[model samples]
Target chain A: MSGKGGVGKSTVTACLADGLTRLGVSTGVLDADLNGPCMARMMGVKDHKPSSQNGAMIAARNAYGVPVMSMDMFLPEDETPLVWEAPSQQGAYTWRSMVEMSALRELLSDTDWGDLDVLLIDLPPGAERFQNLADLLPDLTGAVVVSTASQTAMTVVSRSISMALNIAEVEVVGLVENMSTMVCPECGYKDRVFIGVETVEELARRHGVPYLGAIPFNVGLADFLETGRSYIEMHAEHPAAHAILEVAQRVHFWLKNQSK
Target chain B: MALKSTHGPFDGSMSIVYECPTCSMQTAMLTNRAETQMVRSLGVKIGGRTAPEEPMETLRSNLASGQEVSPERPAPSTGGKCPFTGMVNDAIGAAESEPEKPVWTEGALARIEAIPGYIQPMVKRNVENFALEHGCFEIDEDVMDAVRGRLGI
Candidate 1:
């Protein structure tokens, strides 16, 4: 999954893994958001530590049995801060970037994802890091681009989609418009709260990528995340979750088509 | 001569395991980029994940059946240098699998470890070569004496 930061990519990813596994697909979720990783905690595997073989880490499986791997799992403690400030010495940043990218590649290629039907990668935001991941995995089936329905988010989202389509040479599986509306918990009324004037469907049309669907801005999403429960698991009837399941089905279909 | 292929403790890092052929000494290399890249690109599997086998899988299996698995044969020389090991000219570059580690007596490996890494491989190679020439795999104190006598040292 690729998107701007805070655009609900992690939630979308978690729901997809849950839905896919429920649908009988052996699924794995790779948290590639090194700078801001949240998938482990969001998947309720925050305390799950990986087992080691060779030098590579085996991802810890959550209660849902979805194998989850994140760079943060290797960190000493949950509260330990990650500060990657550029050094003052010449070529230090270049060296650091190379090492960082190498680490990223190792995470992707080294993980023993055995017989996974689908591996949903929760990528860090921006085209550069996405491009780095693209370079690392040549066999990626495609990407799911998440965007909030705002002109500002669309501009960055479109650029990233183009990078994936044109430069990365990976398919843009579809576009998911997250936080498209706010659902009133008491009355069940849907309000188009934060999508600005335009919708992601229009953006997807312009980009020529398939428009998967839209997710409602549910306040309970935050609460569910805080309590380490996936929205799909606890609130399957929630509109946002329903939309995410629809997106997952589309992805499954797309993957099937690619196989054929 | 049971062969042992054990990796550096599992840490999600690319592990380099040195499989000892005769005495069965297992040394892990923490795998350099070339080693890791080779395995991943070839899709070389890990524990309990090996199936729908690929070319490298066969290579590894055949490699286990007394065939040499030279993960070092095609090592990409980084601009006439090795950036992974951070070494420069005349240094014996770190190798993933070198098959021919001339047997060292109890204190010999420790002594070789004391040598600077930049020159240790060269020293090891030279000593191994000396042993091979004399058909002596075990380089104990007596073999060292023979080598010293031969080198006029």
Candidate 2:
């Protein structure tokens, strides 16, 4: 999944992986966002460290048995930031991207992902990073773009979809609109959060891709995020969880058709 | 393999020796303006060498100054044009020329027409481009299937 930062790419990835696993599909996740690695926490495997066996790193498994690999697994502590060792502090900016790419390549190649049905990679923000991943993973199936209903998020996400279609020459599986609506906790009322803008369904139509579904803004989602809880498993009846599972079902159908 | 740097006497350019780990073969490369220009044109840096400006900016400056830039291969000979230079020019000319549209067979046209109207144009363009890339000027059902297999769509 690719999108701008703070648009809940990691959250969506976690929920999608969980949802797919619930449907009896073996899935795995790789948090490619090195700078802001959070899938380890989001997948409910933050306490587990990857173990190396036979020169291959064994990924940590979540409650649903979905293997997850992320930079967060390698960090010594939660607050510590990821820093690369360089020969000198001068002019480090130029080669930092190369280092990050090398790190991602190592993570992908060295990890022992044992025959997963789908390995969802939670990508960081920016079209350039997506391009980098396209180069790294030549056999990439497709990209699932996530965006908020706001114009700013949609504008950036549209560029990502274009890059995937035109430059990367990859298929865009579909678009997922997150934070589309909010359910009032005080009174059980659902209302649109962002008003007077082009809807995500229109954006999907404009790009000729499927509008998978919209995830609601749940007030309890913040607590779930903080505690690394499986929101879908915890609150299956919640509107947000139902929306995510529905999107997962559509994605699963798309995958089944492609395999045929 | 260890890398050793030496300072040039006249131009102040740095020369670095790279040793191959497998064969222990040593090669020296001079970090000069031409080398920097070549690296920048390729949108990458070697070792610790950094581009002072954006790659496109450097390429534009080189083009504006009439300096030949060939990132993939060396600049073709200008004073005494070689056969390779002629071939390169021909390829560049072909690329610059209008792209030849591939002819769609009845079967392929029917298959594409069966697609949903909203995505028909996209699928058609993608298939045609795939056909062209594969040197299939006449697109048929086989070509369409090949495109589908290549894209796994």
Q: Rate the local accuracy (lDDT) of all candidates.
A: 0.63, 0.70
Q: In candidate 1, which residue pairs get closer than 3 Å at backbone N, Cα or C atoms, i.e. clash?
A: A52-B10, A53-B10, A55-B13, A56-B12, A57-B12, B16-B29, B16-B30, B18-B27
Model 1 agreement with the true structure over B1-153: per-residue lDDT tens digits = 222333322111334345568766776555443333333333323222312322222222212111122321232334333332322111122332333566788766776676545344435655666776577888876776666554433
lDDT of 2 by residue, B46-111 (tens): 222222322222222222111122322222324324443233333332332434789989998998
Q: Let me know the TM-score candidate 2 reaches against the reference structure.
A: 0.64
Candidates' TM-scores?
A: 0.61, 0.64
Docking class of 2: incorrect
**Can you give the DockQ of every candidate in the order shown?**
0.02, 0.01
Give the local distance difference test score of model 2. 0.70
The residue ranges of model 1 lying beyond 4 angstroms of the native Cα positions read A1-3, A54-56, A83-91, A222-230, B1-153
Error of 2 at A235 (Å): 1.1
Fraction of native contacts, model 1? 0.00
